[model samples]
Target: MIQETYPMTVGGEEVLSERELLAGVEDGLMMDSTDSVRYIILHCSATRCDRDYTVEQLLHDHRARGFRTIGYHFYVRRDGTVSQHRRLLEVGAHCRPFNRCSIGVCYEGGLDAEGHPADTLTPEQTDRLERLLLKLLRTFPKAQLRGHRDMPGSVPKACPCLDCRNVFRAIL
Candidate 1:
């Protein structure tokens, strides 16, 4: 059962609720046990913030990388629409080594126009992400929230490009 409501505004135009955005998610796979979940890792597409990319494009990109499907469990578009790429139960390819115990969530932008790492999350995306994270936390009560860069042995990269631990500290 869902434990909370996520009401969000995207692009200063449309409003969507958590239920609305996640309504179409299929029960594609089931985790062996929620106990195995240790972290909810956040990521960014690394695309320019001004562009709108779809989940299909990300899937194709992942496929090119030899992944059978998109590497993330969830993908948040620039417009704040959330799409399910892989099921929560499936091991993701977003972060190495931690795949078996982590859930990956990718947002659309992490780059500025000059191609430098930046926190380019749209207001809508930010709002929706907060809600989504909260919901995931409720579902997996033991999981800790983390940024992709926060993982041990990760390369020097600003993935998710935001201090997710500080940003969501209240909820955590």
Candidate 2:
């Protein structure tokens, strides 16, 4: 089931697409046996759109912050490359409190050149994100999608810098 439909290059090395990683989930081989997922939380790296944040940098940053690995289940690069850093069934460390019942999908940018919060999602990212969300909805039909800042008890900060509700209001 690991079709090489989407080709991607990570750090000058060719890597398989996120689709290959999700094949298990697609076939029911990978799923939360307890069905604890209640939310699909979206986040952003909060890096400037002008800068490139590679998956390696993300892993390093998270590990430096005491995280065992990147907290997000999927990391979408600015080029629309989706990298599955964690398993779908594994509880993410992306958002506090909601990690136990949520899947975290993160994009690479969320700030402008001035470091101000802004929706810097590239056209490719927007397209891929919507496609990914559609697939996720197929798997977790009951999960509610929300932006990182929109979650209850979230700190007052613009981590994602976009209104996920409005972005996918028509689709969801």
Candidate 3:
């Protein structure tokens, strides 16, 4: 049977809390004993809207690109199922230079049917993203939210493919 509950790691151990699992993180994952998180960056999978993708697939893609693991800390699927990819305490490969101080959360789909990059977040994806961001904000209270493309020196690309600032305005 398909697993109904997602699994999350807290202090390197698995926890079954649905909210934490669905948020794609646990408390300790976002912070280290000496590390302070400064930003939560949003990204997109850059996949066509008509298909569904998984964190495992993303892991393989990242590995193929020479990354040791999936770069994003969290992966939100089209159906709103959230999956944890990388350990939050580890620096991500999702963004350059700023990776050391940021958490990367990516949602599946940033391309339209015609294969052009677009804001392809489904309603379910949007709702889940909001909830996940809110939960993360509770942990990193002072952290700012930003789209992947908003980072300084970031190449010109609509990584998140949405107005992430406006989408998360109420919480930020």
Candidate 4:
């Protein structure tokens, strides 16, 4: 049978409630629920430096790039530390119009700044990422999953990683 509840626990405890992502706890809004979730965009940090940037750093950097928030709804760190960067309720800063509809979960690494494969997005991370995506898909049933590169003009070099798309496709 399909699971009813999504995975909300991290490090074996409730974590989603502990976030101040998006506006705050007071950001009163709800995403429209339907039998299907339309899209899931795959992305990577494209940084080869290895766990050098903190969540706050990413937020600051993206803001420097002129986004209102950190962009992605969730970020899976190198250590498998999942951070709620933006609320699933609000429109995200990730993929423009697609951000409003798609749930963006970024793997910590997959490609270097040059879009070349690196020793990134480890096996543990891959497992957790798959579990997280599967969980999210159940909650948002209309999740017609895909990648950022699949969209028009999404990257300078069809960025993110190479096999990341293949991975998502396998799961979806």
Candidate 5:
């Protein structure tokens, strides 16, 4: 099997591949302490696969919804660029009621071309999401990985559009 590589930018420097990202995670340079964290909830932007959702659009959309900023702690783009929109220690507005003790990770796309719920995670997104979750796990050993829909009190919606358990089965 061939090893797929993708570009990533962490802290302003461009990381050439997933290998380098893993190395940084191993070095514990990319994550902050989150002793209060009990869950790492995965989400999606609920956008069609053909559309591009930029950071500015996300901020604007969230702001329009009365959010102070992007609610998720991290936002992973289709090309695998992970943005730290909120700090690890900060309480996110994503996943209500559990925001104070959870880290919200949202991927870019979740809808198919016709605008229905589907797992539209690009290869780059899959890799980046996995690595990001791994790093978070290492930083907060007790934290459990969960889908937004899996949490109690979540409304009936396909926010993430996939079963994180099966997608990240290797690491989980």
Candidate 6:
């Protein structure tokens, strides 16, 4: 799936952009600074119980929650297609202390029957994650990959269960 273009349910082919980000829906608060991203924190969105929604729907929901913009920098679909969320080069609204220096990536559908993040990475999703991260590293060479738990206080809540170190070991 590491191709020049990606097929989308968004209706047509979306050429992967070398551009760091898109113009956010909000002009002020939504726009964060583009400092080099030092970390890539992975999270398992807890809404696995009942989510037939898309990344666009999730962003809309965040807007209603009063977010000036989307939270994560990228949203990985169950289908393995990644959608641009907030500006990757821009500070994100994902982590608290590290939000300004980290890039957040949200992968859909991993929670288990107990509502915990399943300790497994879907084959397709992992492959895409690897390819995308590799591409990002070329631009942000110093970026380090970590799980949501690795953040100063992110402390596990079921995410990146795939031995994160092994996942990004090659990139680092």
Please give the lDDT score at residue 20 for candidate 6: 13
Per-residue error at 98 for model 3, in Å?
1.1
The TM-scores of all predictions, comma-separated, are 0.79, 0.79, 0.77, 0.70, 0.79, 0.71
Better by lDDT, candidate 4 or 1:
1
Compose the digit string of candidate 6's lDDT tens values, residues 85-106: 7666665666777776778887
The per-residue C-alpha lDDT of model 6 at residue 64 equals 60
Task: Report the error of model 5 at residue 21, Å.
Answer: 38
Candidate models: Cα lDDT each: 0.78, 0.79, 0.77, 0.64, 0.82, 0.64
* Model 4 regions lying over 4 Å from their true place: 1-31, 34-37, 49-51, 112-119
- For candidate 2, the lDDT comes to 0.79
How many angstroms is residue 58 displaced in model 1 relative to the true structure, after the best TM-score fit? 0.5
- Candidate 3 Cα deviation (angstroms), residue 151: 0.7
TM-score computed on alpha carbons, candidate 5: 0.79
Instruction: Specify the highest-lDDT model's number.
Output: 5
Superpose all Cα atoms of candidate 1 onto the true structure and report the RMSD in Å to 1 decimal: 13.1
Checking candidate 5 for backbone clashes, the offending pairs are: none
Model 3: residues with Cα > 4 Å off, grouped in runs: 1-35
lDDT of 1 at 33: 79
Query: Which runs in model 2 stand beyond 4 Å of their true positions?
Result: 1-34
Ranking by lDDT: 5, 2, 1, 3, 6, 4
In the range 1-172, model 3's lDDT, one tens digit per residue, is 4446546455566645554343333223344532477889999998999987777789888766655468788999999999987675776668776676788899999999987889888889888899999888777776789998888878747788888999878776
Q: What's the residue-level lDDT of 112 in candidate 6? A: 61
Whichever of 1 and 6 has more lDDT, that candidate is: 1
Stretches off by above 4 angstroms in model 1 are: 1-31
- Each prediction's RMSD to truth: 13.1, 10.9, 10.3, 11.3, 13.8, 11.5
Candidate 5 lDDT, tens digit per residue, 83-166? 998877777778877776888899999999999999999999999999999999888887999999999989846879999889
Q: Model 4 RMSD to the real structure?
A: 11.3
